[model samples]
Target: MIAAKFQTFLILLTVLAGTALVARRFNIAPAILLMLSGVGLAFVPGMPPVELPPELVLLMVLPPLIYSASVAMSWREFRNNLRPIVLLAVGAVIFTAAMVAAATHYLIGLPLTVGFLLGAIVAPPDVVAPLAIARRLNLPRRLVVILEGEGLANDATALILYRFALAAIMVGHFSLPLAAGEFALIVAGEIAFGIGVGWLSLRFRKWSRDPQVELTLSLITPYVSYWLPEHVGGSGVIATVACGLYVSWNGPLLISSATRLQGIFFWDLIIYLIEGLLFLLTGFQMRALYEKSKTFPLDDILFATAVVLTIIVIARFAWLYPATYLPRILSKSLRERDPSPPWQWPFVLAFTGVRGAVSLAAALALPFTLPGGEAFPYRDLILFVAFGVIFVTLIGVGLTLPPVVRWLGVAEAGRTEHVAEHEAEIAARRQALDAALKSLDALTAEKEISDEVMRLLRARHEIRVNQLPDSLDPAHHDVSAAGTALTRSLIDAERKFIHDLLRDGQITDETRRRIERDLDLEEASLANREYREGPL
Candidate 1:
């Protein structure tokens, strides 16, 4: 097992290093690169299977990954898009599960209980995967919001459904009325837990001035919030999300910038490392699927994959097609004006439904034998299908996303000025260095600064200020331009790393404080892309 883990680690290093170097030098999604590498590694010989405990899987991989995604998501955006996210995450999960479960049981001749279990497992898309691509692709803010919000919330919804399904399977019965009551109770409980935790976390931060204690307290929030709901027989997934949203929205006002940046950075790296390892594990387990099935049904596995993938993709549109406009239509009758837009580009959203670590964790968590000691019917089938869906979505979406945007005119025609503006922004940024060097003239007050000090300062100053073409006009430079998107991402990634240390409680509060200020300044420099591109 140790050798297997080390081998997994080594492969991840090669993949991440390759992604870092290429993405650093050129503009592209590192996720796409990573997945492609996984695909390539699969075809190559000598890649060993990696089997990990479900407990280790969730603990090691989830907290940081979920936290990082939550931090980047603006509270304002999430609230604005809440309804749609609910449709996708809450309403959609049940809708899809029912449809899939019904189809699976009757069509495939599986027991109703096993069928629902199948439905629950495939309900949520990979949250980490889409964000990784969205960052690199420069997807529209609103669209990205829909994806992220739905992705985050849906994970919880899926988990809740899974729990209820598991109970039904174990206890030898399920009640529609009882399920309804349980659903209502779960929803109420989750809301109460989330709202309560959010308020408590904010109060803790507000009352506590010590950044060290504050950061430490914050680290425990996600896990505690997550499990609190679970312990009470509620949904932990939703609870963690609620806690994250609450903390993020409240943290800025109560928590210092230094602490926030530190937390953000620490979690970013933690998630990346976790995801990279998990995906490689996701891929490595292909052989396990084959081995687990004694009466192997290649045709059955293939059929299941095709069916599950079909349900996931179709069910998204199944919910989205009407949900998008039903609210608008209702509101139009009561309001003076109708302004909301139709849910365009269903194809883009549908295809982004990649499964990942979460699904694997859930599948692995399944009981080897049910309460009656009968074999978990078709356990290998579910894992294989889930894995196959993940592969299809990751590659399918990654490759087609760019064109889908273009085809849908998501990249507004005649307005793709980002590439050029990015180029110009890179050039005029020299003034930043010039300002720094000018500010340095005051640093020599302690002494006619030593020659070595002067030399070092001047060299640093010159390296920056000298890079800009001396005459490049800043006035004409496009403020909306994004330099090679890849470069921007790498810079963001590095900044995130510095903070991840703080978030994980691995660094001093003092260091977190400093990095927070740096993050703010860096953010300010690049924060106006929306205004730069739009009309009032």
Candidate 2:
């Protein structure tokens, strides 16, 4: 059994790497390719079927993904866009769940409670695919922010609702006022606990002062924040998000430079692996679902899946337009402070409602038997339909989003704003460098540092200042680009020469590594500078 599981793991890693390469080569969204690849692999003759455990996704996979995204988010931006995010994250989730429940119950004749359970499973739009596609396509920053913010918080709403529906079905009773009060308490408690976790984690990392230990702490922080609240009957998502946002806002001052650099690479690679394996595993479950689905009438399952899928999609569209404009129309101050966006903005937001692994996990997590020892109603059917929804939305909306953006021409404004952002970045860099130079001058005057050391330090600062383009004009940008490209080539040549010296015994391996590390840092710095210039 161990060997088989190890072999399956290797197979998944191999497939993941190959599919990622294919996606990059063809300019396709990797999530879409990965899902399709998993499906294809599942049907291969003699292939072992992999069952994705519900707890694996809910406990192991979710926390870090949410935390990493939260850490990457700009807290100021998130706060500024809180209203829309709440509208989508909380209001839209409940509205969509209600819509799905109504449609499935009335149209398809599923029991109301069972329909609602399915609704909670499929309500929240998975932001992973949409955000990846949106960022690559250079969609509006505010739109991306809203999507990201919604993704971070919506899981909490949906999961809490899931619990409510489950209790109503299993225990055969639920109270609206009681559920509402409990929901509010959970949100408030989780947020406070999450922030406390963040503060404690930061203090420990700061005290430890070792990069390896700090990285370990960072790795565990999300789980600590997530598991505690969840273990105590709260939705852990809010706590994780709160912890991440707290870290993002305060971490720069507390975290060491070495830890920050290492942590960025560490988190990026971890997120990449986790997200890739998640989609692939999600796709693999189709085989198991297909087998279980045989117990039900095929037409009934198909109809229910289609109905739920349609309701979720249409529900987003129905809820978003009013959500976008209603607050602005009602409040004079809000209208003045933040005017309504164009119709295309809401349309694009609505169209990006792709479901993912979370829903599948929720459905699969349904208990096998209720408290009275009766089989769970519609468990198999719910799982089948949830998987279907993931399949259709992930592939359908993922593929069409690029063309939709193009057709709507929303990206043109984003592109223009992107260039302006780069220009502002250049200005900021110049100012920061100027400040550093002044500090250096002050130290030189007060501390009586050697003239040689001062000269070299000043020269280094000057070189960095010179690297910034004079303006975002085409000519200046071309010159800066040429210099950056040439610098990279020169760095590559130096690395090769260093390796040759090590091979010939002219330098020790340690010596070669030290030199190579410097070159790597320099190359990385150049790449970062170029990235700030934005896509041409």
Candidate 3:
């Protein structure tokens, strides 16, 4: 059994890496490809079925994903786009749930509560897949922000609603007023708790002073924030988001440069493995669901999945237009402060509602037997529909989103804006360097400083300043690109020479490693500089 489990784990890792590489090479969405690959692998002869535990995702996987994304998000951008985000995260989730409940109850003859449970499960759009596609396409910054912000918070809304629906089903009673009040309290409490965790964790990290210890603290912080709120009936998602945002805003000042440097590489690798493995595991469930389907009426399951898929897609469209424009019509202050966006913006938003692993996890977490030892209502059917929704949305929308953006011409504006942003970034770098020089001069006057050291420091600053382009004109950009390419070639030649020295016994391994590390850092900075200048 131990050997079998280890083999299964190895198979999953291999497939994940292979599929991700293929996706990148072909310009396909990794989520879609990884999932499809998993499905294909599941039915191979002698392959074991790998069941994804609900607790694994909810308790173990969710926190870090949310935390990392929240940290990456700009607090100012999130705050500026609060209204739209709330409209989607809170309002749209509830509206979609209600619509699904009504449609499933009246049209499909499922009980209202059971229908609501299904609704809650599928309401929130998965951020991982859509955001990946959106950022690669360079959609408008506001659209990306709104999508990310909604992704961060909507799970809290959906999961809270899921709990209510489950309770209503189990106890055979629910109160609208009481549930509403409780929901408000959970949101508030989780936010406070998450912030508190962030504050305490930062202070602890500051005290630790060891880079490895600080990195370990950062790893555990998300889980600590998530688990406490969730154990007490609150949606831990909100708290995790709050904690991440707090850390993002304040971490620069408090976190040591050594920790930050190590932490970035550490978190990047962790998130990459987790996301790839998740989508693949989600697809592995197809074989299990396929076998289970033998017990149910095939037509009934298919018809129900089709109905729910249609409703999920339509509901987003129905809700987004009014949500986008209605407030501006009613409130003069709102209109003045934030003007309405183009219709195409809302259209693209509606089109990107791809469901993912979270919905399937929720459906799987359903009680196998209720309080009275009876089977849960529509459990199998709900799982089937949830998986179906994930399949259709992930493949259907994920594949077509890029062309849709192209046809709509939305990304053209974003590309133009990106060029302008790049220019501003260049100006800011020059200004910041000037300020640093002034501070260095003041320190030299006040404290003991040698002339040689001062000259070296000033020269370093001047070199960086000279690297900035005078303007982002086509001619200047070409020259900059050529210089960058030539610099990379020179770096490669130096690396070859260093390797030859090590091979010829002219340098010890330790000495070679030290030189290699410096070279790697320089190459990484060059890559970052090119990215900031804008996509090639």
Candidate 4:
């Protein structure tokens, strides 16, 4: 079994890597391709079912991905959008769970406990996949923020409710009052754990100072947050997310720009690996789910998956109907700031809340047999249905989102502050070029170079400088510092591309790695300027 599992796993990895290389060429989302690959694998003969150990899955995958995502998110963006985040993350989740529980129980004829369990299990959307797709699509930042916040927050709430339901099943007692207390305790515990871990991370980062060492420290922080809370009977998912948010919001005030960029890339790759493997493994866990079917009918799993998926979608829209707009209305009524929230994007965000590996892991984590040793009730059904929801949300929404946004007449404009700054920098560059021409004219008048050379330089400068906006007088000025900065940023982006190409074998290896050295020089120059003037 072990040898078979190893060979099977290696084959999946090899296929995924090859698929990724091809996906890169076609600009396809690897996560989607992996999902397709998984489907294909299911049809292949002699493929072993994925049997991930519950603790290992949560520990190995969840922490790094959550932390990496959190580390990449800006504190300002998160805080600025906190109100909407709360509405969707906390409010929508609770509403969705309750409604889904009600709907599943009545419509599917499942017991209330089973219905609620299904609700809780599927309530939290998979942040990793949707955010990956959104980023790839270049969706609006506001839309991404809402989705990330909702994804991060809902997971915790769902876990708390799931814990309560699980406890009820095991101990043979269900009490609202106790569950309420447990909920509060879980929230508090997660918050406390996050704060504690974040504090430790910050101080350690500060003391380490070395980019590589700090990076190493960062790699481990997620595991600390995830496992610590989980081991103590707190919400591991919540703690991981909370700690991530805390770090993202706080780490910058305490770390270097180099560290920040490096950490961002590090986590980005880590998330891709973890998410890809986890999703593929979601297919793997199907085997374990199958083992649970000696007693319960297969129809139960089918009905449960169908019932839960419907409710999850229904609950999202139902909650979103009120949740997205209420805050906007309240802000407007009270003459509060930023009244024009992206109310239209909620549906896209809600639909993107696909259940992925975590949901599968959570379901598989349930004790294989109940307290009476009758085998976990409907375990295979739960796993099967969770996978079903994951599939529907990812592909269904992934394909629909772009066309829908365009069709709704609310296609998000890509007009960020950075873009505005880019325009300003263009104006500055024109001024700089004009000043250079003036100096060139003086040198030419002094007969410093041949007329032909001077004429050629003047002609080249004019053609390029002519492209600048009419508002700026090139004859009288130089590019402003802001313009210089903007131009540098554009250069840096190009440099990064070069660096990635060289690193990824898209470009030939050189004796000295010219692109890498160029990037290093550019980076150091940017830092030295920062040193001269305090960080912006």
Best by lDDT: 3
The sequence of per-residue lDDT tens digits that candidate 1 reaches over residues 1-536 is 88886876787788877776886576565665666666566556777555656666665457556655675678898998787788888888888888778877776777777778888888788887776676455655666788899887787778778888888888878888987888778777776787677779778877887667777777777777777677777767666676678777776788776666566556666676777766665665655665665577788877877887787788877777677666777786523453555344445566577777677777788887877789877777777777777778877876777777666775452234454554567555766666776678766764577889899989977755643433324433333244424445766787788778978989988987787766666555454543443221
lDDT of each: 0.70, 0.93, 0.93, 0.72
TM-score of each: 0.75, 0.99, 0.98, 0.76
Q: lDDT rank, highest first? A: 3, 2, 4, 1
Model 3: CA > 4 A from native: none
TM-score of predicted structure 4: 0.76
Model 4: lDDT equals 0.72
Residue range 198-273, candidate 2, lDDT tens digits? 9999999999999999999999999999999999888899999999999999999999999999998999999999
Q: Candidate 4 at 400: error in angstroms? A: 2.0
Model 4 Cα lDDT, one tens digit per residue, 1-536 = 78887898788878778878987898666777787777667656777565667776667877786777676677688888887788877777777778777987787766678767877887888787677777655567788887887777777777778888888777778999877887788888887888789889989999888889998988888888888787877778777777888877777689887788687668767766667776666655545545566667777767776777777788788787677666667676634656554556666666676776767677767887887878776566666777777777777776676677666544345334334544577777877897998898788777769778878987888866753544333331234335547757887788777768877878877823776666666666555543323211
Name the 10 consecutive residues with the lowest summed lDDT in model 1: 471-480
**Per-candidate clashes, comma-separated:** 11, 0, 0, 1
Q: How high is the lDDT of residue 299 in model 2?
A: 96
Error of 1 at 119 (Å): 1.1
Q: State which candidate, 1 or 3, has the greater lDDT.
A: 3
Give the Cα error of residue 185 in candidate 1, in Å: 2.1
